[model samples]
Target: MSTISAQAALLPTFSEVQKAHRRSDVLILDRHGELIHELRVDKTGRRLEWTKLKDVSPALVKAVLQSEDRRFYEHGGVDWKAVGAALIDRFFGSKTRGASTISMQVAVMVQRGGRPLGHKTFRQKWDQMAAARELEKSWKKDEILEAYLNLVSFRSELQGIAAASRGLFGKEPSGLDLKESCTLAALIRSPNALPAVVGQRAALLAQSLSPGEPGEAYRRTAIDALSRPYRLRPYLALAPQVAKILTAGAGQGELSAQTINSTLDLRLQRFALQSLRQQLDLLQGRHVGNGAVLVVDNATGNILAYVGNSGDSQVDGIVAKRQAGSTLKPFLYGLALEKRLLTTASVLDDTPLHISTERGIYMPHDYDHRPRGPVTVRTALSASLNIPAVRTQLLVGTEPFADRLRRVGFDLRRSAEFYGFSLALGTADVSLKELVNAYRCIARGGIVSPLHLTPGHSGRTLRAMDPKVAYLVSDILSDPGSRSVTFGLDNPLTTRYWTAVKTGTSKDMRDNWCIGFSRRYTVGVWVGNLSGDPMWNVSGVSGAAPVWLEVMNYLHGNVRSAPPPRPRGVVAARVPAGHGEAERGELFLAGTEPPSVPAARPAGEAWHIARIAYPPDGTIIVIDPDIPEPNQRVFFETENEAPGLKWRLNGELLPPGEEGRRWAPRVGRYELALVDNGGKVQDAVSFEVRGQNQ
Candidate 1:
């Protein structure tokens, strides 16, 4: 008796055993406690959450007792009558069978590194029996039975009643019927036994349970239950990407908790996924294969919907870094406004620009390839003019702008010198999550915070930009008239309610992004091929904008999206027509409004502002091998041409022509100057002609 007590002290308590069990999979639930996904974390064995004694089906408990040990309730730990019969048969009878009560089985299960019940020797049997009696003294009958059901293996890879019932019958343990229960109880004896053998044992158990019932009926039912293969039904995979992200590095402690609640709204997640998939279907012919959608509550910065992919690939597009096209324009313009370097009424030249860089002369062009000349900051930003954006980047400085983007959570992963002027055109790579959260910051009046996926998890917020500047940028994006220069009046961007939105298309049409925000929600969508294949003529408006529009519309179906109130330090001022623009009221920072707008140039004032048109500032002329040296001529053209503007090449005055002047090809560096009638150089451009002169 003292030895038995010592053995029981070595074993774990019932509560301790329950606490140590870890489910193989983690359940992800939505904000309202709806199961969204289940991700397997443990690879060794498939054990679900331990089933409690009360939750187990009464029919299953009865079947297990009848099949494994008939006097389970009456015996203290070992069935002495069955044990005596087994001992008598072992020595004198032709057949031998062993009697191990449920308590004894559970005792072996709770013992540290206990051997299998089938292969135990005489000494091991005596120890197991002694431990069983000790366990009965410390653990209640119900505790022993519950531990047995959970610790015993019912089949390959399935270690608990919860896993077995769900794997074999596609239902919870409480929902198990009599025949199903009998089938599972039979698996306890010979786990990997043939289905026919299990069925025969199950039939006998069922017959003993219902002695008045027809034996053949029970046999058929048990056979039907065991004949077919069983597997756990596929989990509710509504948020597989979220599950993957949340379950990363989930150790045994986290797995023991079994379920994690996320801040995702199931209804919104479903809608966003449907919207993305539907948009991908329409763009199928254009080679657009995958896309992602993310929705956030602007106030809390909680991620409401995160559709990582369009069901075609495993890549999580929400966090995948892709080249950010013109999507970063708003922030660039916002930074400029915040620094008081530019205002909404300030005019920016959107014409072709050539700026010298470390690599070479970088040229920026608009999406339409036709420069609109000088445009207001509002129109330039709303229209997404690349040249104006580059000019703005020059004003804000590349390093400062990149730092601002970093403050808003963009992982640029490189120095500003690496990106250069192209940073204004969004040459830097950024993730959709980062992009959406940045937009949410704008929606929240320039305060940037980390987006949360799980409830009660939030990070500190930082002031990324002035609220007044954010308000100004948002107002410009919401204005349909300002964007009409690029996008027409009626489009997916023009919502019935007010919304601030932008679209971006990366170089080669590889990525399309549409990010926007109403008053309460910010929605971002990305459409492209995850395999990095460029789509066929697919722009952001046609690819990602529609999905954004659908989700935004659904989100604001019953809610109002009125324009945000103008923040302090921002005021509306009247501006007269100037710089090829019409007279209108524009928003500007206080004390920065211009007293008078510059007047438009008079008609036919060609000689007033003379600048070279052809072979722009840092031109590189490559001599074609196929063309004759004399036939290859470079046009010496000047904008605002006048009668006295002569073309001077290499400090030598060229002969003036009736129509236009032309220079013959030469393998040398030449400086062409536009000299006025007074012999004063108005504009000069240095160009190099390279090739074999022949």
Candidate 2:
């Protein structure tokens, strides 16, 4: 009796055992508590969350008791009647029968370094019996039964009732019927036995549970239950990428908590996944394999939907860094607008431009390879013109633009000189999450904040850009009439409601992106190959825009997406026709509004400013070796041809004739100047011809 008291004092309490059990997987739940994904973090034996006594099905409890211990409720810890009967059977019968109560099994399971049931020595058996008696005295009957159900190993790598029932039957323990409960209870006795043997034991247990039922019917049901394949079906699994992210460094306490409530909406996540898959299917045979989509709430910056990849690869596309195409143009133009360097109606030359950089000469061209001559900032941005964007990058300075991108969320670790003028064209690599959040900053009126995946988790917000500038950029992006230069009026970018959208295709069509925002949500989509292979003829408008449009339309199905109200410091003004744009109302900064007087000049009288059109400054004209020197002509053309304009080569006057405007190729450095009849230089450019005359 003293030894029993000592053993009981040494045993751990029920709460201690419950707290020590750790599951191998963590359950990620939606905001509404619906399971989204089940991620297995622990690679050891599979153990699910602890199943409470009250949560366990009554049928399962009765079945387990009937199979393991018939007098479970009647015995203190060990049934002396069954033990004595087993002893008598060992002496007289051919086979041996053993009796180990639920309390006894719980004692062995919870004991530190305790031997397994069949392998225990005689001394260990005595100790186990003594511990069982002590455990029954200190813990409740229900506690012992619950611990037994959880700590018992039912099958291979399956430890606990939760794992067994879910792995074998694909349902919760509470949903287990009589036959299913019997089948699971039979696993406790011979976990590694053949399925047919386990099935026979389950049939016997079922027959005992239902006395009047036919024995053969029970046998058939139990056999069918055991014959089916066993697999642990994941619950929901709508957000595998999110689950992987959240459980990256979780501690034991977090993993044991079982359910992590996230800010993801189940409906939106499902729809976004479906939409991305459908778009990738449509782009079949174009070498397009993977894509991702992200949707955020503009008000709170909560990530509503995140699809990492389109089932093509295991890589998470949401965080994968890819070259950002024209998507970064908005922020560049926004900075220019904020600094008052450019306005919506300000004219930007869309013609060829050559700028010297550390790497080499950088030449920017429009998407269609046809320049629109002179266009307003509104038209330049809306049409996604590359030359205008690169020129704007020059005005904003590459360092300042790169700094602006970093302030938002882009992970641009390189120096400004590394990105150079191409930064405006999104030459820097960025992830979908970073890009979407940056756009969300614009949607939130220029205030940048961290996106939250868990509810109630938020970070500080910073004013990345002025609200006025953000509003102006949004207004320009929403105007389809201005975007008609590139995407045309009728396209996927045009939604029924008001949405400011931009599409970008990276160099060599390796990546395509379509990001936009409605009044309530910001949606971003990317389509390309995850292997870094270029897509075949796939553009942003045709590849990613359709998915963006579908998601935007669904989000606004019941809600109206009205245009954002104009903020202060922005005023609309009527501008006279100039720079190839008709007279129209344009938004401008308060002090930068155009003067009321028309700026247009009379035609054919130097109405347009003349700039060297052909052989842009710093051009290296290479003479083809196969062609004769006289046949190779480098034409000198001005932006606006006037009556009195003359061409001067190497400071020498050229005769006024069309043939004189075309100079024969020569291996020498030359400076070409565009001068008026008064010999006043209007525009000049330098070029070097290199090659041996053939």
Candidate 3:
């Protein structure tokens, strides 16, 4: 305890000291400042204001002092009964009570601006006493009481009654009640800073304040514990964090005005939070781990929902920059296609290719490392073939590739040298928000709408590439039947009018992501730990795809995704390559379909089926060629090499088999007949099959 000079004594109110002791006040606000959350963050345990001991709620004040310093009023700015008790103990017995009082606490706290007890000494105590006397003389009794309530320290970081009210009750001073007051009383003893101890302290204080009130004692304990989590007021819990970040950026000024009016909608924020937690949990269960997610409206580029990381505690989140992975493939391809350098139907090799650009020759592989030779560009795009993306980057030029990413909002120039082969693999680092917005450009008809925190505010759109080319890319992404979106690639372009997506993984495997969008909303997610150490086997699909799917499905109006508008450049053609019955009469593009779409039937519920199309072991061939009835004779084509393979649909099995497999009479509720080598029948696999066009 340092001395408060005589000059300091002249300043009795100690307003400077008082102001210094003030902590960060909890702010409450709604989407539009309608009061959604509130809280207080006390950096100091001492906050003092003056209210007369009598003017204050006697029950509350009494509960605190009785629960804390029992001989408070009788002592002259000091608790001597406890002092005598301690002196008798230490000098005569074992003194434990340290001589400190409400007035003396106010003295040292105001004079020294509140310091720890380790510095308590005669000089500090005398200065504190001198200051307390000065404060008491000019200030009313109630003011003294209020000042003590505001300034006294109870326990570790638990100061003044107001702070205690917030730290314990999540409410303001006016809202403090009898139970809350008693709880604060108990806290003054230890403030162990532990909610439970505060509660027990409250109980003990209640016992001292009202010796026989058992109910009050019980209520004190219950009330103290209830205050823990609520200590973080609602707004303090959610949006104030936004304010903290924003305020740091703003010059000294009113933070509330700048923050409350931001474009973020509380409802949408809630939707984003709930959406992330639920889906991420599901993703994590599948060993996918954590990531960041951001959703924006294509119509306004307003960030409807922005989740920075998998969780608040995660490191590589919305704010963190990491590898963009294969998700960047579409934008680059879109740039090329927009330039008329390529078309949706153009042939791009999924086969191994060495692109020796000015930088280096890049080699890439498909996700499964499986090479399907000579697939169309449509197939390559649909399947997210790494080789084609690498080739396109080389053809497009690495400088242009980097420029396009920047145009779309990614900051990749810092590491210009790493933009060649690694470009296809998203080696360049970008934030989740940046990648999501880049993809949002495709969803918005090739319009690049930069995002903002405030809605009414708008930004200039840069025509980084042509609409036709971007549309071509999206057209491919939105087509499930496109050459690239294959059956093996779980993420297929949807025609339900709602979806298109791509995922990425950061370098060394620390971060995995899934970024997708529809006509209305775009979402991005990243999952990884803080240490930059990639979780084992975590990839874009394995880690982020499931969560992305869940959230996308939710945001897609809880319905299937719809395809993009068909570009005129893409026209249905009856090609000369197809002749007679030997030549199939299926719709084919002039060149080739975009690789992003997997060949599949029209997007609808019936096609997904009840089961067996879930990759069945046997194929179904109609036995009667002329059959038109629902109950046509269908034979099971069980490849002889697939023996011991069982066939089942919808739970009903076929006739018993010699070894373990059998056939069914109908398509619905069919299960394969099974018998093991030990003469024991294996359990059936149920599935459903429908009409050819279904």
Q: What is the TM-score of each candidate against the true structure?
A: 0.78, 0.77, 0.61
Q: Runs in model 3 with CA error above 4 Å?
A: 1-58, 61-162, 166-244, 249-262, 265-288, 312-316, 355-362, 414-417, 483-496, 506-510, 558-694
Q: Deviation in angstroms for 14 in model 3?
A: 20
Quick one: RMSD of model 1? Answer: 17.7
| lDDT of candidates 1 onward, in order | 0.84, 0.83, 0.56
Decide which is better by TM-score, 2 or 3: 2
The 10 consecutive residues of candidate 3 with the worst lDDT sum are: 578-587
Q: Assess candidate 2 and give its lDDT.
A: 0.83
Summarize candidate 3's per-residue lDDT along 250-323 as a digit string, tens digits. Answer: 33222323224445556656666666667657656445445556767777877655555445562436767776
Clash list (residue pairs), candidate 1: none
Over 356-428, each residue of candidate 2 has an lDDT whose tens digit, in order, gives 7677888988878999888899889988999999989889898889989998889997998887788888889
From the highest lDDT down, the ranking of the candidates is: 1, 2, 3
Task: Encode model 1's per-residue lDDT on 1-694: one tens digit a residue.
Answer: 4768777887788999888777788889999999888788777778888899999999999999888888988989999999999999988964977689888888887775322556789888888889889888889999989988898888887889999998888899999988888889989988888877887788888878987655565556656656777677646777888988898887544555688999998898999999889888988899999999999989888889989997946689999999999999999999998888998888899888999977889998988899988899988998889999999999999999999999888988999999999999989999999999999888888899989899996689899888878888888888766776788654688675668899999999999999999999999999998998999989878999999999998998899876676656666656777775555556777778776643222222111235577886567888898887778888877654555678888888888783347777778888887776556554566788888553
